[model samples]
Target: MKKFIALVSVFAAVLLVGCAPEVGSDKWCENMKNKEKGDWTANEVRDFAKHCVFK
Candidate 1:
């Protein structure tokens, strides 16, 4: 049971990490561009401008 739990935890972590591009990365910028503007959080909008646009 412990082994199975550990495997599931690891799988969840991997899936979470793989679900989004790293912040400020080119891929992240592209993803933001494609994503719905209405769905973006305030912080995401700020970071997108700070890192993706200004940089």
Candidate 2:
């Protein structure tokens, strides 16, 4: 049971980390551009503009 729980935890961590590009990276900027504008949080907008646009 403990081994199964550890395996599930590791899988969950990988899924979360693998799904999104690192924030403020070029890949993240491109991802933000493609995602719906309404879905973005205020901080994402700020970071995207700061890192992706102005840079």
Candidate 3:
């Protein structure tokens, strides 16, 4: 049980790290650029358009 718990904790941490990308950072902007339009929620698309685009 203890080993299982430790494994689960590590898995959870990996998931959390993958979910959080700093908004408007270079990495986030690159992800936004490469992702299909349908992959983003409306709010996320709006934010990317506003913050990630260059004129």
Candidate 4:
């Protein structure tokens, strides 16, 4: 049981780390702003680069 729990914890940690967004990029800043405005969504952020002004 302990080994199973440890494995699950490690898996969860890896998943959390993998899901973290890249910081300092324009997409990151836009995501932060959207979160502050309560309009953040993963899909919306994913599409941001399509309409990004930075090219």
Candidate 5:
């Protein structure tokens, strides 16, 4: 039960983080720039390039 709750919590957190502002929007670009490069996952980096950097 404890493990299940922890897993659910992690899933919720991931879901929330993935709910970023729309790609290419000002807020999305701002977030992409401000996030620490070391902290970015592969998907996040890709998104940054596809949306923020390329824009």
Candidate 6:
């Protein structure tokens, strides 16, 4: 039972991480272009991608 739970946990984590949006792709590019244009910082772009694009 313990081994089974551990395996399930690992698999779940992998699935979650794998579904995360990757940086510097078409989605990211579109997100950047659509964002308000006015001296946005790198961190802002990253956060936008993580929350808006990824989610």
Q: For residues 1-55, what per-residue lDDT tens digits would candidate 5 score against the true structure? A: 9999999999999999799688678898798788888998888888888887776
Q: Which pairs clash in the backbone of model 1?
A: none
Ranking by TM-score: 1, 2, 3, 5, 4, 6
Model 2 worst lDDT window (10 residues): 21-30
Q: Model 6 over residues 1-55: C-alpha lDDT tens digits?
A: 9999999999999999898556566665666677686866988677666766676
> Residue 23, candidate 1: how far off, in angstroms?
0.5
For lDDT, candidate 5 versus 6, the one ahead is 5
User: Which candidate comes out best when scored by TM-score?
Assistant: 1
RMSD of 6: 8.4
**lDDT by residue for model 2 (1-55), tens:** 9999999999999999999888889889889999999999999999998999888
Q: Which one wins by lDDT: 4 or 6?
A: 6
Q: What is the C-alpha lDDT of each candidate?
A: 0.96, 0.92, 0.85, 0.67, 0.86, 0.74
Report the C-alpha displacement of residue 2, candidate 6, in angstroms: 0.6
User: Roughly what TM-score does model 2 have, to 2 decimal places?
Assistant: 0.67
Using lDDT as the measure, the top candidate is: 1
Which pairs of residues clash in candidate 4, taking residues 3 or more apart in a chain or in different chains? Answer: none
Better of 1 and 3 by lDDT: 1
> Could you estimate the TM-score for every candidate?
0.69, 0.67, 0.59, 0.47, 0.55, 0.44
The C-alpha local distance difference test score for the whole of candidate 3 amounts to 0.85
- Tens-digit per-residue lDDT, 1-55, candidate 1: 9999999999999999998888999999999999999999999999999999899
* Candidate 4 local Cα displacement, residue 9, angstroms: 0.6
Cα-based lDDT at residue 48, candidate 5: 82
**Residue 39, candidate 6: alpha-carbon lDDT:** 64
